[model samples]
Target: MKLFLTCPKGLELLLEEELHQLGVEDTKQTVAGVQCHGDLEDAYRICLWSRLANRVLMPVYQGDAETTEDLYDAVQQVSWLDHIRSEGTLLIDFTGQTRAINNTHFGALKVKDAIVDQIRDLTGARPSVDKVAPDLRINVRMHRGKVTVAIDLSGDSLHRRAYRLQAGQAPMKENLAAAVLLRSGWPARIADFDLLLDPMCGSGTLLIEAAMMAADIAPGLQRKRYGFSRWTGHQKGIWDELVAEANGRKAKGLSQLEISLVGRDEDKSVLRSARQNAERAGVAEFIDFAACRVEDLEREQLPEGVGLLVTNPPYGERLGETQQLMFLYRHLGDKLKEQFAGWTAAIFTSNPDLCKVMGMRADKQYKLFNGALESRLFVYPISERRPEQTVREEEDVVPLSDGAQMFANRLLKNRKQLAKWVKNEQIECYRLYDADMPEYSVAIDMYGDEVHVQEYAAPKKIDPVKTFSRLQEIMTAIPVALEIPANKVILKQRKKQQGSNQYEKQSETHRFKEVNEYGCRLLVNLHDYLDTGLFLDHRPIRYRIQQEAAGKDVLNLFSYTGTASVHAAKGGAKSTTSIDMSATYLNWAKRNLDLNGFSQGAHQQIQEDCLKWLRMQRTPAFDLIFMDPPTFSNSKRMEGVLDVQRDHVDMVDAAMRLLRKEGVLYFSNNYRRFKIDHDALSDYVVEDITFSTLDPDFKRNNRIHSCFKITHKA
Candidate 1:
């Protein structure tokens, strides 16, 4: 007889190999399943021992199904009395459809009609539909005008091992958990007495599955129900003998089992659920459950031996959640290196970018699925060399050139000079070095412990090879001078960006670092783009807005990441509106606001061309408005190109129209040669407050940006 065993997608090859190991040698891999030649005894053994299959199906009929009538006839070809009695309950699981049967519901209804009609005609009785528990569960699959009717021997999916009585958030199915263990090489590791640990083991799914596989316990041993339990053709004697054999094997396997299994989660409730689940699976004595954080994991948790640490941490789907979870992934990697050196680690996550900050190199990576979400499993062999030791080894060999030593001396002097002021102002992010020397034209800024270095574009007369050498010196000097590791330095080249080029992503590494700026928490990515989310030149201006924003309606135009708007909202603004042209920045702004306890209601973000939006306003509604248009932009998303130098008067006039009689509008830009057209805007009084808005870090480059204060003339 031929049997079809179904599993999740991407596991077809594994499932085929598993069937071969079970003595069913003739197997063919197909989409999400495997087809094999097996007798009744083999089928029974698979239903008990197979860990990756979702269902075991025995084909009963095969014929053409070009229409609904043809499908009914194909199902009727099966000998109904041999499989199920006329008075028994049945359920039909229909998949696929034809032109005549346009949907699965209608196809299933037609199949049910055929089965009941045949049974009633023969014995004057018919089975009623039972969705929960059925005496006969039929599966009908139609593909390309052909139908294959089969009896489902496994009622529920094999993932439903009847051990997980309660589940935590985003739980992994049992079959997938089993596959994760198998792929991580847990079976081989167990034979060597290597320990197994899951740091984020919610509900103990991975732990219980590993225990079952190690103890020779059948995955279906705890399951009290199956589709074949009430089928008329079920061979009771064969199934009973298999069960007895499995029980004996399990007893022997348990007596010899000596490997350690440990699970840890931060949530106490989930840990309780995990313990209960382990007990129900009859593996509670073999595993240890604890409520501990990954960052707190120590070397004392296991004996001194090479082991495996496997876990599926939360991979958030939203931008805000992803930013917050980056720290968690980093901590997990840090702990693995610090405490579990010489061991192997496997991390399963949906977001691959999070793996970049793991601080270790992966030996192997495999793509799999956690239900519908595509995910990756990365395996790493933790090296015994510590991080500090590696850093010291690197420093001893890398000698700085004369120019780099001079630049490093300047960095030390600047940091010492700003130390007092930074402490007095409670500033966590500030510029440590600008182009102090003519030879090196790079700007270095410190955001907490991380450093961002931007090298200015060299002149056409400069040699490319010489410029590259200078950049290398800067990279070496910054880390050494700052006493920070080389990985903490994020380097990028500064060049003129046209239109939306500045907003476009330079890389896909979504590593975000959180910094505190005057009691407000903000996220900045130094490597993903040309500009970090927060602008250091406009720091004082944002603080000015925050100081005067109490109970005022505020507006921020071209609000990239909404740093200014966040400051305004934190100042107790009555309402805030942030408008930008890119949905990416708008979502970024939303995340910034949400990070500071501001949500949907009084805070609004609109994705539109700021100039176009300003013209659409017909009424005076805002008391304070800040406009920081780009110097030049010809983005395709906008109605027209925006040249701040040429169009500043008109843009300011449109924005001022929405300001009340006593309201004030702050207009700023970075066009160094931009001069205000005084004659064009005689209705409002404008003051150039550029010098007042300049902070100490930007005082060296006085023309970095221009600021103004405009109000209705009295």
Candidate 2:
């Protein structure tokens, strides 16, 4: 029989290579899968052991299907009784589209119609559709009017190995983690690397996959269900023998293999999840979990033999993340250089440019994908003999692209343009250049001694290499033009953060710098968070809060780092309350209050969801409230998803309830599509203060955020 093993794009060649190791010959690589000639047992073997395959498919028919009628006719050509039972349940997963069938769902319906009709005609009954847990899964692919229908041998995608009971933020799929291990040639060279370590392991997906592979455990052994089990053509005898063989090998492999594994993460909650996942994978005894920061990785001991270090480090997808994560990358490189003399390290990340900061030249790199975004697996041999690039050379006067030259000229122009305004307004920090030039897509801001450059995520059509080259030129240009050292120039990429991602920590830097905004001395962290302690665009807003805060009981909700709370405390508020879910930021808030020399007698910081805290409030209503919630949040701690645009009404009302009758509720959000929800807040008089909330620097981009002053109608 002919079979195809599907996988993520760019891993087709890797999957084919894995099949070759499994003794399946003549495997041909396709776009996102591998085509091979294999019998039932060979197909089952691939399903059981092929770590990279998303699904194992057995094609039963191939023909043209241009129309609905044509698809039905072609699907009817297959002998239904020989594959699935008429009494059994099955489902169709249709892919691709034709002129007649413009969507997957409609095409799926047509295919289902054909199968049900055919089965009914032959056996006087039809198989029912059970999508949740189908007995037999059928895959139909339509490409350029041609369709190939295959019976899915693996019921669910082979990626679901049933070991990962829980996952950390941005967890890599189990199969992708397995592919990373396989791509490193770890299985074939298991004896070479006795110790596998993941320093930034969140939930230990990589370490668990590595451990399972080292133990020679079959990928599908933990899975209790298979598509072929409920099929009429199932071969129980062959599958039973394969299962027993896999079990015997696993039992023996565990005792014989002396390889050890260790995973570490700074977050204790995250380490707990990794431990639970490892235990579920049944390799808990072989691995150890610890809570440690990347900078402190030197204390961990490396085994006597060759060590393999694999990590899925943070590839800062947003503007602030890149700058903060650069420290992490640099630390990783430093630790590897100081220790692990004879080790192989594989770092998988979507942004390869960030990986360069490690100062370690990648000896081997394979193109792969975490999802839709193209990624790379960079393999480095940690040794004194290995040649690596010096990060200092970033300023070595390389040829600048027209884009880079334009970027530098714009920075100079913006600085010249904003200098007079800065002097007149006494403004220390503001947005300098915000993707003003199309090609050089980045926002350059000066925070006293530091120049923060945020690269806007480029379109897919743009070449990433040219983009980074242009960025490196800008990174070099900023210091020379501004008379600052290269070390003071911070860089990051601006990408829209989604879900509860912004609350998650990017680096364990724990570093903070104090800077002046207007007349207030506020603390800002260029590293460790996507947003610094202060929002530069909201400088005027904080000033407004300060002016209105005197002789009032002030409240700051979602008060990250308590920058606004500090402003309120400094403004002589009779009482101030700061509410936030993150303990880290709350602690920073306390420190910010201390730095400003504010008394703690009436200043309070409550750690919790602002919404929940507001609900518990009744007496001692606040005279002023600054409520700036996240644009969207789905934190596990959150009761439900928070879409600022959708839930702004309820949020505004809740904060209003905590405000005195004559008090003002300053409700604001960075969500671009946010509106004031006039109908929901009919009881309050709403005034749009967004325009008045800007200084000269933010006049170019007033829509970056929207603010409203809401007051109860008297």
Candidate 3:
């Protein structure tokens, strides 16, 4: 049978590769989804082992559809009685394009009507529609006037997996959380590492997923029911055989495994939930759950080798307070710096500002989406700083601008060959665009006929002669690799004024331009922000959006220069809206959209706070919404700081208000300490969409961003 595997936007390739390694045949990519041919046993095996797929679907039939009658006729022609009995309960899910069948519920109603009509004609009775606990679930997808119907082989989303017996405030889905651990290189055979720890282990999802992986336990083993079980074609013997094989493969020598796994949370209820989840996954014996604040966590007493610590902390979005969380993160960083010597630590958070409080530099970083929150996973390899390192006061460094023009002239002359090379080779994008101090140290972008550049001034510690020489060497080497002549490169130094305040000088000196690359136009300006023009970490997520975006309306909230929007529009979003408070960013977004030929009436650029705009919008506005808010932002225009950990409930509520009933909202944030206010959001159905967004490039950093897909409860 042919099967479809659905995952979050970025992980299709990963899922495809996993399927191939498992020996599943005919694996291929389809938009944001994947397709493979497998028997009932293969389907079950995928459910148990696939770390990337969200659910497994078995296609039953496909036919043409031009109207509601055509849809009903096509659905009715399927042998419904063969798959679903009259005594069972049924549910229908609809997706994709259909003119008369646009609304999911209306489409579901038509399918249900057809199924009942067909069943009644044959059996004299029909199954009832049960949205929850349906014995058999059918999915109908229409693409370009063609309809394909499938049976949802997995009952609940495969992410449920039955391992989680209890949940904390904002628990991650088992599959997604597991994918993070796998992507981060956790649970591997590493030597000389202390242990794997989640400092803010709400519900222990991360810890449980880690423990399961460490034990080689199939995630789906705990699930008791599947949609296929209710279908007539399900082979009990095959399923039993698969389960036995899975059990036989389960790790028996866990004690022989080198690493220990630990999770700590401040909430007592959350600790209880974590323990309960661990027990459900049958790994309670292997995982240690403790109730403690991040500040109180100490390095375990182990042998000489250092351990690895990875954590997802609060983003202060939903909790209504950020100052305390910021302070906690700062203290957490201080503790790591002072205590966890020789240990490698990865911090997952959507909040860059909070990350700065740690006052430590990460050795590696990756972009990930936690739910719909855009976040970063910063890996700080902690060990003793080189003893030769010494603190120097700002007063110690010589000023390069004290003698400016002579230095600038010399730098320009040295880079003359490099500039010509840049133009000759058409080096579209390169770092260190300019290094004219007294003026700026800028990065240059060569986009065919356009030259986009960002300017930066020299750092206080660097000497003019040394800085210019370094810039010349870098510029020369980069263009040569691109086969460009040095005369084509344009080098410019940023100007600095005497007695200017540090903040003013830094803010004024930096500038950047947008460029188009790989079918998407991006605004790649690294000078003004810590991140340059592109986020290589979210490379997968953008790929997913582009792949799945054809003919869909995309809503991008907190759309920083609309990178995702650019990808989505280029991927074929019928319309796109980029919302943010900064006009500067909106203008940049417009430039990117224009570069992609999507900056016209079909795309809307809104310069407003997303929260405010969401509150003002009505329902059924967009098909897909991508929201990645800052961990903490206190704009002068807003009444308070926008905190993801604290404001998530409200943010979700607002975003959902604009979503079409069947539409999905991809909400993400970088707040490592973020906890979902599940109680506050009991009405909407939420799934942790993080795992499907994990890209291989982000293996070093876990919890890049916590993402969730939410829709109104059916």
Which candidate model has the greater TM-score, 1 or 3?
Answer: 1
Off by over 4 Å in 1: 20-26, 39-41, 81-90, 96-106, 116-135, 165-171, 235-256, 265-272, 291-296, 311-539, 542-662, 667-710
Per lDDT, the best of the predicted structures is 1
Q: lDDT by residue for model 2 over 1-714, one digit each (tens)?
A: 899888999888788878888889978988998899978999889888888889999999999889999999999999888988888898999999989999999999998989999889888988899988888899999999899999999998889888877888889998889888877777777778778889999989998888888888897899988878787888999999999999999999888878878898988888898888878877889888988888677634545666788999989765555545666777798788767777989999998877877778889999888889899999998875344334434456655566556666777888898889899988878888876767767777888888877778777687654565566667767776787887788766657778656555656777788898656787888866656778788787888888888899999999988889888877778988999888888998988888888877888898898777767776747999998898988877777788898888888877887788889988888988777778777888999989998777778877889999898888
Q: What is the C-alpha lDDT of each candidate?
A: 0.87, 0.83, 0.71
> What lDDT does candidate 3 reach at residue 122?
83
Task: After the best TM-score superposition of candidate 1, give how far the Cα of residue 221 lies from its true spot, in angstroms.
Answer: 2.1
TM-score of each: 0.64, 0.65, 0.53
What TM-score would you give candidate 1 relative to the actual structure? 0.64
Look at candidate 1 and give me any clashing residue pairs: none
Better of 1 and 3 by lDDT: 1
lDDT of 1 by residue, 1-714 (tens): 999999988788889989989999999999889999989999888999999999999999988889877887888898899999989999999999778887898888999999999999999999999999999899999999999999999988778889899989899988888888888887866655468899899999999999999898999988898889999999999999999998999899889878889899989999999999999998999998988977678878665677888999988763224433655787788788767877889898888877766778999988888888888889998888767776865674667789889889999999898889898999989998889897888899998899988778787687644665676678779888999988788777666766766666756779888988887899999889878899998999999999989999999999999999999999999999999988888998899999999977999999999888988898999999999999999999899899998999999999999998988899999988889988898889999999999878888889989999999999
Candidate 2 stretches with Cα past 4 Å from truth are 299-305, 385-714
Off by over 4 Å in 3: 189-192, 251-258, 300-304, 360-364, 388-714
Q: How many residue pairs clash in each candidate?
A: 0, 3, 75
lDDT of 2 at 399: 55
